[model samples]
Target: MPQSETGTDTAEPVTDHDAQAATDADTDGSSENGSVVPWTSITKPTDDTETLAAMTAASAAEPGADDMADASLPLDQVFAVLKNERRRRVLGMLKQTDDKLSLSDLAERIAALENDKPIEQLTSSERKCVYVGLYQCHLPKMDSMDVIEFNKSRGTVARAANTDAVYDYLETAAPGAEPDWYRYSTILSVGGAAALGTALLVDPMTPLPVIDGTVGCLVIVFVAYGLGAFVWTHRAD
Candidate 1:
């Protein structure tokens, strides 16, 4: 209205307005980018769900096992086999006196004589040494091509080198000797006989019906026989 000659009026300066608009836009952009703080400077939460779940999973996982282990079978036989070691040092120690070695003593001796260096370095070496003796020393030798005639029940023992042509044929056909079938059969037979004997003894003293005691004893005997048969015929693959 005042500068009518140019048909315009210079009401306000653009510099201040433009600067204010830029400052507001920058504030909004900074908020959009999360924050003005550097990435490394930000504080992470202590109880993140993903991290907690990962930690729990790791805690729950079972530890890995060592590969050099043998199948755990009859404890006494396994113990005997493991007792046969390089130079039979362990066996000799046991034979010097019929003393059962404590875990600590066994570990110390085995660590002193172990073939594997990593095994020797173990601080709690007893467990490892026992494992080696049982699996590596005993089982393989027992399973080998050599003919070993050992009585599990009587503790009778003998060994002979494989020279027979028929021995080769047997080994080739069976791979391993058909696992001590006679021993298992004998065990089952003894159990069955015992059950029958118990049933007879109890039947005389038992009350009302003869059928209950008879049937129970029969069940027990049958179960024992079944278990024995399974133990004998089954081979670990």
Candidate 2:
């Protein structure tokens, strides 16, 4: 009878040498050194390493880095330092003007512009009117906030609070803005009055009787003028 054709009996078995040869081939010749080098074990972070190195170099290259360590302040300080728009405009005008303007002169210029007349043609009264109005009205409020100073002798005044910083900020922020002298005059004048009031209140030199009599009279006059201004500005509105 013919031999049975079972598949298990016909299978071939591998020798030990063949198995060793197969292992060597699988390792790609690394097995000869008694250690197999892993093909995908560790990788160099070329892109990431280069980025980190670049950032470190950049930080080192910056000048005054140590000096600028305190550059940023808390939000409260930032808000406190910022000036209002009107004050900023006044500072800018003073910075750009070669001849510092007196309160009257500044107001005259504005009135002239509004009236469509030449600034040079404005009469003394027109100018003084602006000055008085501003001194008695606008300036006190601004002075209360410490935005400017009035020089009683020179008859000239200047920006008092954060003037430089405010101007610098405005130069970048509002390059096209021009000073509104009417507004400026008012603010400065009121500020001056406030200063006077403060001096009287603080210094004992101010005569108490004079304050109740002369100073009181002046205050009444100022209040009256201020009321007129309010009405005028109101009607115009």
Candidate 3:
């Protein structure tokens, strides 16, 4: 009776014009001059650009491998240069005297020291041995480490800017000196440990039940002794 409602119902059709209008509405929000602009084109970095930026950031974060090697070179050179007795003598001579010495003078003094003779009394052979070694080998090596300035043409040598680095490794004791700082520090540490142990056993302070004064004193003594020994051993000449 109601005109067969289900079969008679009608609906609007989606035509090409309607579809185009919907598309325009969707793109218009992001369009300028009737052209859609992609957000990625403006905001996203290209692959090559991103790779370069990553590389730059990495470089800033860490030192190059060669830099690490260079930093370690000086200490290694110091040890290597000091291993030879002649080189050690050269450094000693440079350190002791304020004036720059001629290469010949340095060789003469070192030869005399080596032979246990007066410089004036050194044999030509002994002097020659020292001279050749220093001139050909030791001086150049020291110069490379910046421990000494060697002017080959002038036949002169003097302390250089980094001489202190070499001096740090040099032993400070004079020949046949009694009880060097190292030995002295060891003895002091042992004595201190013993005295603290004895005091702790005696309980002289009558420590509280929960807090042992003797044990506390012992810890303090050992810490202080260790720090003192470290300072004594590593102190500059």
Winning candidate number (TM-score):
3
**Which residue runs does candidate 2 get wrong by more than 4 Å?**
1-89, 98-100, 168-237
Q: Model 1: per-residue lDDT, tens digit, 68-89?
A: 1222233454434433333244
Q: Candidates sorted by TM-score, descending order? A: 3, 2, 1
At residue 84, candidate 2 shows an lDDT of 35
Taking all chains together, each candidate's TM-score versus the true structure is 0.20, 0.33, 0.44
Top candidate (lDDT)? 3
- Which residue pairs show collisions in model 2? 134-186, 135-189, 135-190, 138-187, 139-186, 139-187, 139-190, 139-191, 140-190, 140-191
Which parts of model 1 have CA positions greater than 4 angstroms off? Answer: 1-179, 208-211, 214-221, 224-237
lDDT of 3 by residue, 1-237 (tens): 457777775888999999978776655346558677555555655699889999999989897664554454477787787777678778887888888989999999888776667898988999999899999988998888777899999999998766766787876548854225456557767876677677666665666432355556657876887787566534431
TM-score of 3: 0.44
Report the lDDT tens digits of candidate 2 across residue range 27-85: 54344568865444444446988899999999888866433422433334323434333
Error of model 2, residue 5, in angstroms: 99
In model 2, how large is the Cα lDDT of residue 144? 46
> lDDT (0-100) at residue 215 of candidate 3?
56
C-alpha lDDT of candidate 1 relative to the true structure: 0.48
